[model samples]
Target: MELINNLGLGFTTVLTFQNLTYSFFGVLLGTLIGVLPGLGPLVAIAVLLPFTFALDPVSSMIMLAGIFYGAQYGGSTTAILINLPGEASSIVTTLDGHEMAKQGHAGKALATAAIASFFAGCVATVIIGLFAPPLAKLAFQFGPAEYFSLMVCGLIVSVVLASGSLVKAFGMMVLGLLLGIIGTDSQTGLQRFTFGIPELADGLSVAAIAMGLFGLGEIIRNLESVKSGSMQVSKVTSLMPTRQDLKDIFQPMVRGTMLGSFLGVLPGGGALLASFAAYALEKKISATPEQFGKGAIAGVAAPEAANNAGAQTSFIPMLTLGIPSNPVMALMISALVIQGIEPGPAVISEHPELFWGIIASMWVGNLMLLVLNLPLVGLWVKLVSIPYKFLFPIVIIFACIGVYSMGNSAVAVATMAGFGVFGYILKKLECEAAPMILGFILGPMMEGHMQRALLIARGDVFTFFREPISAALLILAAVALGLVLLPSFQKTRSTALVDED
Candidate 1:
């Protein structure tokens, strides 16, 4: 009864004219962004974060959430039509999806992707409604020690799950932690790494760093790799799936959704991991695995469902426990901080309207995406044909403007430029930036919690182990780190990550 009431209130909040309009605008822009290659939701959100200051928190959140999942819907369009994945999660879709396009079943493949995504999204929303409250309730029992241990577990899990060299990931995370502490010390008000720069007083801007690392960095990288020739887009003869196509896809979609929902709740597990895992599962279970990369409808359906489901369910940790499951969730936490709302157990009780409104808006946005994606398939196909040369400049311009607007200072823009160059160098070195961003976001909070916990325990070093919850989290972190060091697990990790190459 309470759940129903909360959902009702959420709908009431989201149904407002301003909220609905922004919701539409968000999904629309997200679809457009996804249709364009080399621009993901991270870049889009980072570039737009400064502009959200004018809107109310609820409207801003709704818009941002829409952009996050809406990209999933649009990404498959390009993957099927032009053999290019608009989002990283859609990379698996390019396998069988492009194969289907070449086989002249592009419309069928697109229809399967759209239908699976919609169904998975709706189910994931319900899962969030049911599971998030209990998780948030559990979070209320945690103290500073438990929070600190949980962060340790999260960082370890991120390291274990990151698709790169373990040493590089760990190094990046440590660097991020170092960067996170650059601002004035809260206790003594002494500058740590400012070097007498006035702009460093507030620490590095999250917007600047995010835009530089993801937006401009990606733009620069894409420029180097841009092909000179035009792409040949597949034609959509029809948009409806046959009855057999539906039958072939139903079971894979269900399995993918279930697997994706569970994985999505884990730290560092999001759409990219979910989609890859789902595709592998489907291939493993199929009687004729050879059909996987050769235009199998199941191949198209499973990964599409998983990525969309994972995208939505990844919000659970972020919303309930204030733990980010991925870099995008890190950005969402930044948004919450900007809104003066702390993300944790109290978010539901203190701001039920904002919490539920974001959830309700997702359902509304999914429906909007379903309507928008199918009829506009041709439009999206045309969008994929746009050259990177034309698209990147606009993104660079917006990213600079957004960073500049944050402080109206050239230093912020310069900071972004420096990070952009740094980001490109990191990319060239094969170091993943996601874990670094996650560490930067979590480091300060982890430090604060650890300090508070020790203060409460009177400098007792074993307080973390003395608390049962904290002990369990630390043990989990230790076990995950241990597993990563094992040779067998290293081989498995290499196999899983090789798909990205």
Candidate 2:
């Protein structure tokens, strides 16, 4: 009954004219970014973060959440039409989505992606509404020791989630932790890694690292492939799916939504993990497993559905606990704080309108995406024909402008250039950048919580194990790390490795 009342209030807040307009605009902008091959929602949000300062807390959150989930809709369009996924979460869609396109069912594949994504988004949002409050109540019990142990576990699982070379991932994580140590120490009021540079005193900008690592890195990588000849874009047919197509996809979509919603709330694995897990699960359970790699409708539907569910549910940690289960959610948390709205268990009680409004906006945004995506498929398909020479230059210019606008600093531009070079080399050396980005986001929080925990524990490390939540998190992290090291896990791991090569 209370949930019902809260949802009614949420609807009232979201139904306001101003919030509705922002939600629409967010979905529109998100679609544009998702359709553009080199760009993703992370870059889009980072680039636009500074501009959102004028918005009220609820409105700003609504807009950002719209873009986050809306991108899931547009991501599959490119994945199906061009065999290129704009976001990491969309990569699994390319496996069967592109294959379906090759079979002259591009429209049907796209339709499934859209409908499944919408359903998953709505269901996941409801789950969040129900679970977030209770979860946040539990989080209120966490002392600094619990928070510290949880962060350690998150970092370890993040490293294990890396697609290749555990050593390199660990190395990158340590480097990120070291970089996180820069600026003045909160406890002793002394500078640690500033090296006497004025900019270093304030600490490295999140905008700088994110834009460089994701935006610039993508540009450089694509530039290297510019001369390697053009890609094969699948031809578009009818824009609507047949009745048989709908029947075939409905069950997988439901399964995916359930699985993704469940997995997304977990600390370490979010959309990226959910999408992959959904794909594997679908293949295992399917009566026609042999059809999975060969244009299976279930193959396309399941992961597409899962990715959006996971994307939506990831907000659970961010909104309720003031912790981000994923890097993208971390970015969202940064945006929330920039608006002076501190997210935690109390956020729901203190700002019911904001919490529920964001939830309501998600459902509204998903509907908007479904209506927007199908009609625009032809326009996006045409984009696939753009020449690499023209595209690569524009990508470089966008990266530079995005980095510049985010911080208003020339040093940030320089930092981007350095990261660009480093990222390129990392790619060349067969190291994955995904885990590095995750590590960079998690490292600071990990350190802050650890120091706080030590202070509260009087330097006794045993306190974490005394708490059930922290203990469970530590054990899960251990199991994940152990699985990565085991010989059997490596075989499955190798096959699922993102063939960035």
Candidate 3:
């Protein structure tokens, strides 16, 4: 009954003219971003973060959330129609999706992806509404020690799950922690690493860093490898799937949704991991595993469902615990902070409208995506043919404009440029920027919590162990780190991350 009333309030908020319009535009732009290669939700959200300041918190969140999940819908379009993956999570879709296109079942593959995504998105939204409140309630029990320990656990989990060298990920995380402390000391009223720069007093702009690393850095890399050619788009004859197709995909979609929903709640697990894991599961279980790369419809259905489900449920931790599951959630946390709302357990109690409105908008947005993806299939395919040379300059200009708009600071622009080069270098070294971003976002909060806990305990370092919850969290962190260091686990991790390409 409480859930019903809350959902009623949510629909009322989302059904407003302004909020609906923003949601539509957000999903539309997200699909466009997904249809185009070399761009992702992180870059799009970062580029638009500054502009969202003008909107109300609820409206801004509604739109941004739309973009995140809507990308899942659009990514499959490129994966099916062409061999390219528009988003990292869509990479698995290309294996069977493109094969279906080659066999002249392009329309069937596209339909399967859309239907599976819509179903998973709808189910995941309900799951969020059902589970988030209890999680938030549970978070209310956390003390400073527990909070700090939880962050330690989260960071360790991110390191364990990160693709590539654990040492490199740890190094990047430490670097981010160092960068995060570059401003003034909150307690001492003195500077730490300002180096006499006035702008450093307020700390580095998250927008500037995010835009530079993801937007500008990606553009520069894409430009270097830009090919001059038009892509061949598969022609869509029928958008409708056969009755048998629906029956065949229903179980895979359900299984994928279940798997993704569980994984999405874990630290460092999101759509990319969920999609790959889902495809692997389906292939392993199938009686005719040989047909997996030969246009099996289950391949299109499962991963599409998993990715979309993972994308939506990834909000659980961010909204409830203030811990980000991925870089995109880190940005969402920044958005909440910018809106003067501290993200965590208090979000639901203090701002019910914002919480429920965003949840309701996910369902509405998925319906819109289902409506949009089918008819506009041709439009998306046509968008793929646009040359990268033309798009790269535009992306760079927008990134610069967005960063500069924050307080009109040239120092911020310069900061972005520096990070762009730094990001490119990290990419060249096969390092991921996600862990660094997470550390940067969490470092200050973790430091603050630890300080408060120590002060309360009369400077006793063992206070963390005295608290059962904190002790458990720290133990979990140690176990996670220990498991990742094992030779057998390392081999398994590498094998699981191997891409079809």
Candidate 4:
């Protein structure tokens, strides 16, 4: 009953003209970015982040969430048509999706991907409605020690989730924590790393750093790769799937949806992880596993559904506990902070409209993708052919104008430029930025809670273990780190090297 009422509030809030319009535009842009061969939602969202400053918190979050999930839907288009996975989560789809295209079942493959994604999205949204409130209530019970322990667990969990070397991921996280402490100390009012600049008093601008790293750094990286953007598509017979095709896909979709929803709430488990896990599970369970790499319908349907479901449920942690489950979630939290709203368990009770509105917008965005992506397939493919030379310059110009617009200061823009170079260097070093960004966002909060917890315990560090919740979280962190140190785990990491970034 409470869930229905909250959703009723959500639908009412999102049905407004302004909110609906922005949501539509956000998904549209997301689809466009997803269709491009090398472009992903992370880069696109980073570019669009600066523009969201003009929007209300509810609308900005709704739009950014739309972009992230919308990219998951759009990525399947290229994977089926041109053998390219625009988003990392879509990588599994290319295994059989492209084969389906080659076999002249392009329309069927695309339709299955779309319909499964929609179904999974509906399921995932309902899961959020049912589960988020209880989790938020649980989070409300956490004390300073518990919060600090959870933060430690979050950081540790990121290293596990990261695709690259665990050592490199941890190094990046430490760098992020250090960067997070650069501003004036909130409690002491003393400067830490301002280097005699008044603008540094508020710390580095989130917009500048995000735009520089994701927006500018991505452009530089893509330019180095330099590939022709033209796409080749198989002939489309019809968008409708046959009864047999639908039957073959239904169970896989259901399985993937359930699996993804469960994994998405876990720290560091997200769309990419869900997609890969679902694909592996489907292959393992299939009677004729040999058909998976061929044009099997289940191969196309399961991962698509899992990734979409994962994308929706990944919001659970960010919205409920104020801890980000992924870099994209971290970015969403940044949006809330810019709006003068501190995101945490209190958000559910204090700002019900903003909370529920974003949730309701998820279903709306999925419906829009189903309607827009089908007929617009040809249009998206054509748009992808536009040269990178034209795109990156516009992106650079947008970054400059947007960063400068943050405070109307040349200093802010320069900070972005510095981070752009730094981000490029990190990319060259094969270090993932996701952990770093997550660490940066969580670092300050962790320090505050840790200090408060210590002060309250009268400098007795054993107090963390005395608190059950904190003790469990810290134990989990220790176990995770311990597992990473094992020789077997190191060998597994070496053999299964995946790149989320």
Residue-by-residue lDDT tens digits, candidate 2, 1-501? 999999899889989999999999999888877777777888778777777888898888889888888787778888898888877788889889999899888988888899899889989988999899898888888877677777777778777876677888888778877777788777788898777877777677766777677777777887777545577777777878889888998999999999999878765567778888899999999998999878999988899889899989989988887777766786788788788878677789889999999998998898889898898887876775677678766766766776677667787788877887887778788786656665666677777787887787798788778778888888988898898999888877777774322
TM-score-sorted candidate list, best first = 1, 3, 4, 2
Which stretch of 10 consecutive residues in model 1 shows the poorest summed lDDT?
381-390
Q: lDDT of candidate 2?
A: 0.81
Evaluate model 4: give its lDDT: 0.86
Off by over 4 Å in 3: 499-501
Q: Point out where model 4 deviates above 4 Å.
A: 498-501
Model 2 sits at a Cα RMSD from the real structure of 2.4
Candidate 4 local lDDT, 57-90, one digit each (tens): 8898888888988998888998888887878789
CA displacement after TM-score superposition, residue 246 of candidate 1 (Å): 1.2
CA lDDT of every candidate: 0.90, 0.81, 0.90, 0.86
Once model 3 is optimally superposed onto the true structure by TM-score, how far is the C-alpha of residue 153 displaced, in angstroms?
0.7
Residue-wise lDDT of candidate 1 within 372-443, one digit each (tens)?
A: 998998888777777777788888899888889878889899988999999999999999888888888888
Better of 2 and 3 by lDDT: 3
Error of 1 at 161 (Å): 0.6
| TM-score quality measure for candidate 1 | 0.98
Whole-model lDDT for model 1 versus the true structure? 0.90
